[model samples]
Target: MRKKYVIIKVFKMDERGVKLYQPDAQIKKGWLSLWRQMFSELIGSRELIWRLFVRDFLAKYKQAVFGVAWALIMPLVMVGVFVFLNRAGVINIGTTDIPYPAFALLGLSIWQVFATGLTACSNSIVAGGSMVVKINFAKESLVIASLAQALFDFLVRIGLLVVVFVILRVVPAWTTLLVPFALIPLLLFTLGLGLILSLLTALMRDIPHIVTLLTTFLLFLTPVLYPVPQGKLFAILNRYNPLSTLIIEIRNLVIVGRITEPLRFMIISLFCLFLFLVCWRIFHLVEPRMAERV
Candidate 1:
């Protein structure tokens, strides 16, 4: 016993190193511990998030001849087209005394942001499948990157909007300060819906097409091209459509220089938050499986 001795050796493995040890069990254990790991991974990848945002920004304009200038011009052309249509009486933007172009453009701007964000995020995981499968990073980063791209586009459109406001001599009111506040719920609403749709699309593959159709229908349901009519049904739809309320609130603040009805704000904000929390829970639950599916 005094002369005999045993030596045990341990080795660590790297990406290229031969595997020295492996866990054989398939069923994941320690639910709380797994969640903590996921959360920590997300927090640690903040720099990666910034890089993703920059990549999305450049990717949008890459190889495009006009580059970011296209962003400035596209909205003007859209507004010009709307003006022509409204002046020609092709589409009647409802009863406000504001110029049809201004009214339509304001609503369009908000709708476009939400729509673009939804569309981009819904397809984000499918489009970034390689990263989802091979990379050890937050899956939510796909949706966040899509949103960052949409936000950049929205900001560019806002600059064009300011130019239009000046050209039309439209004076923004002090209430315009609330515009950013109004945007909070809208972004939350969009993010919630986007995350849900994106996850569904990743599974169904047909959901993206369905989402496109639904968005088209929602545009009409919303008061974007026209005002919400004053009737029981229209009023009900308007109140229920988060985008409609968000757009209406933004327009009221920026164009009419008034805060939206407090009750409406409360309702919309609460609804948005509720939807966001629900979608967030769903997202976290499904995210761990995304790499396998993608």
Candidate 2:
């Protein structure tokens, strides 16, 4: 009877009897493991991404008077300003092989993709705060949707570019067909920086303003209007500035049927790819905390 009365069960618990098997509040994870989980989650959320893109695409033009023409306005304005200045002798941009209008338009079109895409993605997380808080979805979807919108705008501008090409009677080389491939580095670099900027903007509202200011200044730093410079200082700058190489290469492919710096383009493309993966991982890891901040 005494031996039978001594039955006891042991349960795993903290000192206060809280279950030790409960899910961790935060887990330490290796970078590789985190990337695998992030990618898996993103793959599963592909439908959500497409839906979000459609929602954003429709919403963008739903009430706009000009519709997609708004995409044309910025590049047109920039081109107009510089063309006026050049014609008025306020500036002397060296002669371009193509018509000055077409040259500037081509460069602006490429630069706009990077500039607008970065701006859109950087603001996406904060802009979607209501949905982010209320819905269960991958936040990466917002960034991707914004990028898709930028791409849509880019495609629309391409139509205008064709008109410019036709008007100027500028017959691009066969390599012109390959010009689209040059967007690879621009997309990777923009997406990489955009992810990081989105998180920073979410935490600190001032980031968007800073980005706006910097973007305006960056145009001059990049060789969008003026030709790539010849001085040793500028030579070094152009060499290091990835946009310079990318834009120059695209122009060369279309106008000259050659790539200016093949090795540099390849190197920058790889660097951008690496940057995107790492920034995306950081974004994924920090995403759970975004709702609270925003």
User: Cα RMSD to native, each candidate?
Assistant: 8.3, 8.5
1-294 in candidate 2: lDDT tens per residue?
Answer: 432211111123346956332222224334354556578778998998889889988898989999889999989998999999999999988889899999999888888888899999999998986888888678888998888889889899989999999998999899988877778878888988998899889899999999899788888888887777677988888877888888888888988998977898889889889999888877865666666677
Summed backbone clashes in each candidate are 0, 0
Kindly report which residue stretches of model 2 are placed more than 4 angstroms away from their true locations once superposed. 1-30
Tens digits of per-residue lDDT for model 1, 73-160: 7556777886788778997765764666667777877887788888888998888868778885677788877877877888887887
Best by lDDT: 2
lDDT of each: 0.75, 0.82
Tell me the lDDT of model 1 at 130. 82
Question: Candidate 1: lDDT of 28?
Answer: 38
Supply the global lDDT for candidate 2. Answer: 0.82
